[model samples]
Target: MFEQEYESFWKAQVRNASGQRLEMLQRDLTGTKKLLEAVLLPVLGSLDDLILEYEMLSVSGMKIYAVVCLPRLRTVFEEDSFVTHAEKITRDRFSFERVRARSVAILGYTYFPYSRDELEKKASFCQRNLFELIGRVGNVEGTGMNQLPVYEREVLRFAVYNRKPFQLKDVCEWLQLRKEACRQVVRELEFKGLVNAVGGSATRCHKFMISEKAVALLHRS
Candidate 1:
């Protein structure tokens, strides 16, 4: 009964704006808690099933799950097995990097209690910074041999626009480049100090973020 309702709710959400989904959940905290309690808590033991189900959802749906459901089910995720499963999902080439990154970020967010107000404030600040960085980078001089490659520029643009860290696999998938070629470009970016690896690993699954220095340099140019 509730499952049917949940499916309908999700379908309706698919038609709505991403921000609207978050806003709806935030507006009815009690109802959201009840829904999580009734539906999500029962399936906490089946992490694999949950992940697969979520995999079928859109990126916005995934973010909604993270922002709304995960907080209420924090204990389930804190389990070693669930954490392991999430790590595996992060490395899964089949999954979208944005979804994986959101899952990982939500897991981190679950460690402490935070209000909608707090989350919104942080998101706003990050978005502001990301746009500033993107604007500066877009205006950098020389599109020739001295400048960053088109692919690398696309990567920076994607990261800033999405406001999310991304893995090499994400780059390859989005840009339709070979894995090795994407890795080489990422390495070149790192070498030039335009980006930084999150886990300090050059491996494919590791996440990369734009460096503050790159933004500063672009802003100064």
Candidate 2:
């Protein structure tokens, strides 16, 4: 519910890359390559990151796009070769190791014939990676707030899974705990910087976002 603007931004980014859309992204998103790694590393394991990037880039006749500039780096880094590789990779069912071995450069090209179906398949694969990557970034845990209670951890997990803010009632319903108990748990969690609460009442919408500090903590763990 609260991420309507973000969803709109994501859709606009995926619109056919031309005119104002292309120009808007180039001006705003240029030189923003590192953002992709930052957004991807949290959700995707190292191998997944490599495959996701390789699948999302464009080469020659085929092109690539993402929900945001961050995930689009794979496309930008790769050129026509990505298109070629996409064709081969889709048809041959290559091993992950082979894909990794062959597609080492930021963008490398391999030759394969293209079909309309391949284009759609490539786009679908890339889109799934983008959405998964975004979800990982949004719910990332920071370093300082690692010591949450089991119930509180569940609450945060539920919030992120739903992709919206959590209210007291929602948390209570999820954990099957009393409202007061959930509130106390949430309060303790907030004090530790593991979760956030906004608004004034039990019905107040609370967005349980993870902080960078918590992400660092998770990394250490």
Candidate 3:
């Protein structure tokens, strides 16, 4: 189907354009063809194939192709297998930022389907919870009965219930702490084996999830 569409588009361009404009259109078409060959062609292949092909392009190129290909590949995106792959890719530490963000945005639009105002309201609610948690923890001196800091304990509890890996921005939204402070706490949790960095990179936005140890501690508590 895509090949047929591309062929038609190519023929139309060849017929309608001339000179420098035709040359420029041909160049654009060539780039689009490369993108399709690299990324779109492996729709049913391993997630690694998609990621590798996507990384072959520049960030700006990624944005452009994502905007173009996503709509056309809506059915692919809607498939259960592809959705599972997309979720994993979205959390991959090695995945490029633009690609990860684009994948996440598309997934959110596909599955969650939220309006701008509704999204803002949910964000605000998360922020409020984070601020409240911070205040509550601040009022306490020592770690809870388990010797874990109040904040850490609460964060663990939250993660256990949520069962989803969360980025630093998500943590800050939920904890209302500065990024540095949130990062420190997360690192401490990681060191203690209470949480694991599940997705993204240290140099960029990363996600953390509660470890089995944290879940056990929560159960013990």
Candidate 4:
């Protein structure tokens, strides 16, 4: 469901120790994705919904260009643009300027410390929201999303991670599903009351979000 083919991280890594060693720092990728998919997508849509910053990789102070996945907002933005993003965690991994060049909006930086206390201390508004989001990923309480089919779970996870309105085109591209098939999935979610369509009746029904009922239940989860 993570869609490795859609993930630039796995597409062209050397796979030897030199490349694989960086796996220890996967939180760089995961955390970035979480922030964008959850906190930043809404503002980003208003800025540049047509394109995205996608995945980034900086290793040992060297800028590494990765294979680009075109025409979508990718989850990861691996940059060390500020003290908050990488300098706080480690040095010589990425560049703030290079990452900015690829970005639509300049979101805040995030530092994921191994210590919960340290993390809780420096969590700016963005980081605090992201921290709560991380909690929701692996259910704090089993809310039955586990019972869903794999594809349904993927879309639901996207909705939950987004915590905001989204479009079928975005999810379809992000999840690598055919358009019609994704519509069917959304239809199922609407029936289950996990999702619902949103828009004026005069306008086309193009926007959707996690249902408020489901959101209320999930917050407690």
Instruction: Choose the strongest candidate by lDDT.
Output: 1
For model 2, give the 10-residue run with minimal summed lDDT: 45-54
| lDDT per model vs. reference | 0.48, 0.43, 0.46, 0.48
Better of 1 and 3 by TM-score: 1
**How well does each candidate superpose onto the true structure, as a TM-score?**
0.37, 0.41, 0.33, 0.38
For each candidate, how many residue pairs have backbone atoms clashing (under 3 Å)?
A: 0, 17, 2, 1
The predicted structure with the larger TM-score, 2 or 4, is: 2
Model 3 ranges with Cα > 4 A deviation: 1-145, 201-205
The residue-by-residue lDDT of candidate 4 on 1-221, one tens digit each, is 33343264343332322443344333344443443343343323222221123334443333333212212212233323345554574444345534534442332222222222233343345544543453345243354455667677677666766666888897797579899999888888889887888884645677888775554443232
lDDT of 3 by residue, 1-221 (tens): 66675576557645765654455455534434544334334322212112111111333454212222232122112111223344465555335644645554555322112222322345444333322332233223332324777667667656654667877777777788998888888888989998887757776546787675654343221
Structural RMSD, model 2: 12.3
- Candidate 1 lDDT by residue in tens digits, 1-221: 65565555555544543554535533434433342333333323211222211212433564333333232222112111223344465545435644655655555432212333323345354334435433434544431222667777777666656556888888898689999999988888889887888875445448888776554443232
Candidate 2 residue lDDT tens string, 74-122: 2222222343445556544455424433443335432222233333345
- Of 2 and 3, the candidate ahead on TM-score is 2
Highest TM-score model number: 2
TM-score for candidate 4, please give it.
0.38
